[model samples]
Target: MISAAGLLVQQRALAGRDYRLIGHSGARAAFSLGRWRIALEVLLWAVLALVLAAPLLALVASSLVPAYGVPLNFNTISLSAYAEILFRQSITLTALKNSLILASAAALGLLTVTVPAAYLLTRRKGALANLIAILIEIPYALPGIVLAVAFILTFAAPLPVVGLSLYGTIWIILAAYFSSFLAVSLKPVLSAFLQMDPALEEAARLAGAGFFRRMRDVLLPLVAPAAGASVILVFLIAANELTVSALLWSAGTQTLGVAIFNLDDSGSSDLASALSVLVVILVIALMAALEYLAKHLPEGVLPWRN
Candidate 1:
């Protein structure tokens, strides 16, 4: 009834359809599992995004509004609050300056203290080393308020030799920051040390490199990425910290945290909201920078990256 060529073409078409329709049961099950996992992953991401973004969006919206009770609308939105923070508030500027200075100092100081200490701890392991490590971490393990109180008590009195009281001073805050965050700053560097190859340092030592020379030429270069991470981490934490600074801040030494708290406490929620928005911007920028640097950094340097 049909030509041979037409019969052959019809048979080929049916074969193609059969091939498309047919698949192993295992393959179908795998595809279903893959789709399910993707859906779950997407759902998790959505929840996380909502949780993180809601408060930030609320703060930004509040900052844009002129008053606390005013709803965000076309007529209510204003930039006056931001202007007040930037132009009218000298206290805000002073707090920003002090926070920057203290954070920078703390980061540098932590790097100076933690790098060598990490190297020593990694190179030498003994009961004494373990004890020292625990002692160093003890303050950080304690609550920040406890450490703040301890600092206040310890430095409230004038030093016998210098006769200078550090309490109620920026120095006292710095001291507290150092004690509270030293362990935090040490973590990345210590991880770096654990991952580093000892043969490289040993090779340098055998080749007439002295302690300082080997450290400079061999060890520092390897550990630099982690050190950078430590500095940034400490800087961010110290800059935005409230708990320790709240207790230690004197009249002139009010930090950003104290400033924000004071602004809210004084019933100037609008100004506080504006300042908080700026702080959120700053934190976002720093995190973005860190994310950008994550590719260049060591694997474990960023705890959240993985």
Candidate 2:
């Protein structure tokens, strides 16, 4: 039989007390959250260090050791393995040269085709463009083994007109690299094209600038960073690529991937490890160079930067 007004007042008092209590505890809650965030960041960094640095350290250590089953330490380390790979191994040098050539060629080829193709795709919107995009993505989406099989089957026989066979040749490997990496090379350029304003081109057109002129003056400058990114990405992938190269390489055309596999397969694990260390060093150098170059690039050009 309490009065309604009294009940209302009591509820209000309870609410006010609850609000004051929350206000008092808010700082503690914030402090707890901050500690948790710091802890999480530290944990994440630790995991990354383990995942990335541990293997690299182990590789370097192994490469320095004289033989397999030998414990690696500063005192046990020697430069003999390095000297052997660099000076003595002819096939290693060949593999390195081939990898460099293939990677460089692939990067340039990818950029040449993808820049115009991406621009065309971005400019033209239709079912055809969509269909073509899907087609381009298919090879990249499929496993490397599948693509290798397809290439082998298609090129196993001599061409109908030229009577030329590309199977088990460097050309076949290059073709596979193109097919597998085309989509990757196109994505950044396409993204850049999509993000660009049409008004720039229209203004150039108003100035009587032709297609090539407009592309040179406006579009190329705008998308140069993306193009650079594409080149770097495609180069890295093609250089380090294994599965396709392993399947397609001939005796004289053996790439670094094939060389590495062959060395390990032949039970030259020490030599393989040594070669692998060099490859890792090369990869790290490239990535570091890219990172340094990114400062001069357009804001969104390097995907890993942001």
Candidate 3:
């Protein structure tokens, strides 16, 4: 009995009502999802505070206390622990110096080797390069303890020509570090090279730039940021290194990690805690520096950034 116009009008009214319902449901679903995301973010922050911030606060507090078991209070707190580690303890100073030297040496030394090796590995692209890459990675892939043992076995004897022994010496530790961290130092430079256009180097070559000239002029400038990042990464890891240094360290060769362990073992827990706090501070400062440098470096050069 209805006219066609009236029927069309009725259908349009139903469609509008259905659309309103759908719009309301969608808004509700979006609101619910937003609430869940906020809740998850809050939970994540809470967990980080509980796990990371709490321990760090406790460590700082413990380091301030005069002794390991002393209760932390305004009256009981003192800077003696820090002073003792910084000025009073000769062993601690030695350990600090050794750690710095090793870290710097390892970082710079690895850069020289990794830069050329990474260049070759990146540009060559063949089965031989792949095999060499795998070989370089094997030392790092092995457990620190395993690699340390392997080094000890390999260098326990005196050299044939030099007639000098590396076992139980800093040289041996440096060698182990070279092997263990070769991969770490290589990765950033390799990433930089991979991202680079090959045409730039080719153009330089066509212009009669020799290998060293090209590397010094073209390649080095391009990869400097990544190389710096690699150096920092290697320095950070080597400075705090424990496992490899533990087995290789002899008299007067204690690294920071070894010093911390030795201090705790010898019942100088307060000193150990103080040293640990300093190490933490150093690490935080370096990370902040790296974060600031991240803006200038290429994407993905610093893994922690994004």
| lDDT winner | 3
* Global local distance difference test of model 1: 0.84
Per-candidate TM equals 0.86, 0.85, 0.87
Q: Answer with 1 or 2, whichever has the higher TM-score.
A: 1
lDDT of each: 0.84, 0.81, 0.85
Clash count, predicted structure 1: 0
Predicted candidate 1 versus true structure: per-residue lDDT over 1-306, tens digit per residue: 133344445444644232211232243233456668888989988998799878778888888998788899999999999999999999999999999899989888989999989999878866676666766777766777888999989999998899999987899999899998898899888877877767889999999999999999999998888888888888888889999899999998999999999998998888999999998788778888788767666565786875
Give the lDDT of residue 48 in candidate 1.
Answer: 84
Q: Tens digits of per-residue lDDT for model 3 on 225-299?
A: 899899998998999999999999998999999999999899888899999999999888888878877766766
TM-score, candidate number 3: 0.87
**Candidate structures ordered by TM-score, highest first:** 3, 1, 2
Better of 2 and 3 by lDDT: 3
> Which tens-of-lDDT digit does each residue in 258-292 have in candidate 2?
88889879876677888999888888788887787
Candidate 2: count the clashes. Answer: 0
Model 2, residue 155: distance off in Å is: 0.8
Kindly indicate the candidate among 1 and 3 with the higher TM-score: 3
